[model samples]
Target: MNQTRRKRRPDPSLSRLDSLSPEMLFPAKSPSLTSSRIRYIFLLLTFCFIIYIIFSYGTTFRREQISSIARSLSVFSTRRRHLLFSIAASHDSWLRRSSYVRLWYSPESTRAVVFLDRGGLESDLTLPPVIVSKDVSRFPYNFPGGLRSAIRVARVVKETVDLGDKDVRWFVFGDDDTVFFVDNLVTVLSKYDHRKWYYVGSNSEFYDQNVRYSFDMAFGGGGFAISASLAKVLAKVLDSCLMRYSHMYGSDSRIFSCVAELGVTLTHEPGFHQIDVRGNIFGLLCAHPLSPLVSLHHLDAVDPFFPKRNRTESVAHLIGAASFDSARILQQSVCYDSLNTVTVSVVWGYAVQVYEGNKLLPDLLTLQKTFSTWRRGSGVQSNYMFSTREYPRDPCGRPLVFFLDSVGSDGTEGTWSNYNLHRVGNCHRAEAVERLERVRVLSRKLKHDVEQMVAPRRQCCDISSPYNKSMVINIRQCMPDELIAMNT
Candidate 1:
């Protein structure tokens, strides 16, 4: 009883968290500190909730910034590739391995011959890197003298093949963007009995000096195929004439010039179109010959990495698109950075458009991209502008929204017409995106092809392209009395 009396009297008025019992420590309501404690707890909880809200929003905002940064970095990587090559000053054994170079065809054996513009051969080849390190200025053909550029390329093709690379029966002025329908081409070509009358798409048309050369048989606009004998004949003609007129602007004109010099007639076939520009119907694949024709000169979407159809998807619902029965060929250029000559990496053209209820309505008329611009530095750069049909944009905001592109290059026109606004917004908001779901799925697929190109080097000498496995008969064997008019 004496010990119990001493422990009870310590602190009944004093409030301590540790001193409190099970019920008294945190009672639902108590006379001492109950009201004040409830108010303090409410304030503390409100502050914590505010902090959590701020942290959550801040985390979301940071994630968006990081995503935007990644996109920007990817875009910037393309621009910096030249810079990387510039800094890397080594022509090591790796580059010289020949395996590093794709299309491992023995230049001697392969039928493909490239004829690029050759104005800068001498100046360019003498540099540290025999090939261009950056955007070649007056490059491609850097051989001495202004030699129509194509000749230099032809010579390289000839020399490479001559050096025991591969056996070539036919010669094609193959373009970069053109993807061959090898199966159809070889099959159709095998069936042909006469080579005298060359076969091009029977429905092709050509225009020269305001005179339209519409053919019932075929039209040859871009690259065309020729027998080795025809190639020799053309080579001889170029040998006789190129030294005399090396400064001519048009390479295609040079082809006509060679024909004119040799007095050789050209036969046309739908298969030998510039590519996606024109073709015919009936006894072939797709009968619908589009506004853009096809041949050696191919018109693919913008980038192989991101193929977006530059023009209107469908001509339906347009006010006057039905009038576009016949195709019109216009030589357009997109000047990325120039004044005198437009830099056309991809083949394309500009079409004017008007939007009507989510439809990208296009005008049938062909418009050209003017290679001219307002000056920024010392040099007057080419203005990258396309002619518009009826562009209704803000007069002060963006001025005009136009689609512009070039020929034989991946014809990626710059216009928001093809863009599905809601779809793009969804892309921006999506947590994760699939490439196949985007507008440029084809482009992504094409870009992926670059990996295949740069992958394992094929042996040039043994390189028979399985990609174009056709009637790979010897040129001499194919040469009967009727084919290519060769008696031998």
Candidate 2:
């Protein structure tokens, strides 16, 4: 015992258990280990986020690039792009034989909204919602006769601005009689930027008041394009400017006056024809200027472009030639005097015209006939100058001439030697040569331009790619090759 009894040796297992500490059973956590695990998790999440961004951005870039390519290749776009047609129609005229029938069937109908007079909404229960003048209290002033229509101009500008769809780059205004080449319209608009204010249309000098109001005023009957930015500016300030131009002759003049304040000038495009005369427009369309044929106004007064043909036939005939090679057809088929009193009808590219002045062959050749032939061996050789170099003068002014295609034994077509044997008048020949040279230069330039438009180099997206049904049809009609390639 304390005895001095020696303590028994402790059991080894019991001793070990008793000696164990809390620190040995459960180890303390390391700060570095916890931080390493957190770092691994953060890296994984960042990698996933980066992958998502790449996928999204890559898809968008590819799509944008493809669309740009498509637009650049074709003259007309498939997307209903660029124009908002504002049609001016009277309540009585909307359902009339001359207006509604043509308007309903037109490609512009869907994009167009008819602006009618007060109480016009109630006239026909079947009609769609139309804009009326009475509602626009902003520019509330009226005048007599045709001038009363000017009030609607301010209202249309205001309402269209209020609508404010950025996609609508142009605000096109026209009378009900106007026949639009919607495809040509988009093609024309593609040439300009809508961000800058622009007033695009043609002028009319048939009326005395046209020059009196402003020489720059665009004839509304022929239709006009107001750039979206310019339209917005007009919407805001037009009401204020109306009072100053109250005495203006027509809506076109009023609009001209308003835009002039903002330093916007008219961009005259001759393709838009205001054919004020009442007759057949076959001659006019055939001889249309170098620009894309935009519209033919006063259709109600004139016979259709192809009077004998129906809608389908006439459209087919006009579509391709009108969009791509209008100038070529014009040069070949159209023959008219300066007074427009004498016109030749060239059917299937063959016709003959006999003009008479007081004396012999007249020097005034308004629409001269063009003929071309290549030399047998020379590449791209033309005998046009030789054939037109001399003209035999008859006392009775009877000069029998071959008009079209002729071939020689040497496999050369249109050789100058095959036609005229006699040499006579110098003045007429010199005049003809000068005219031919001018036409030749114009033709070369046109061909170059058309080639550039149809098969342009693949470049970065410069213009917008918008679509419309009408535009699609036009593009198909005009530039089928590009359209096919784009889809493929």
Give the number of the best model, judged by TM-score.
Answer: 2
lDDT of each: 0.29, 0.49
lDDT of 2 by residue, 89-171 (tens): 66676555233324232453335556777543444323334666455445545554555656775467667667666577788
Look at candidate 1 and tell me the lDDT of residue 46. 100
Highest lDDT among the candidates is held by which one?
2
Give lDDT tens digits, candidate 1, residues 420-488.
111222222111112212111011001112232224121100111221111011111121233221112
Which residues of candidate 1, in runs, are more than 4 Å off?
1-148, 154-169, 187-222, 268-488
Evaluate model 1: give its TM-score: 0.30
TM-score, per-candidate, Cα-based: 0.30, 0.51
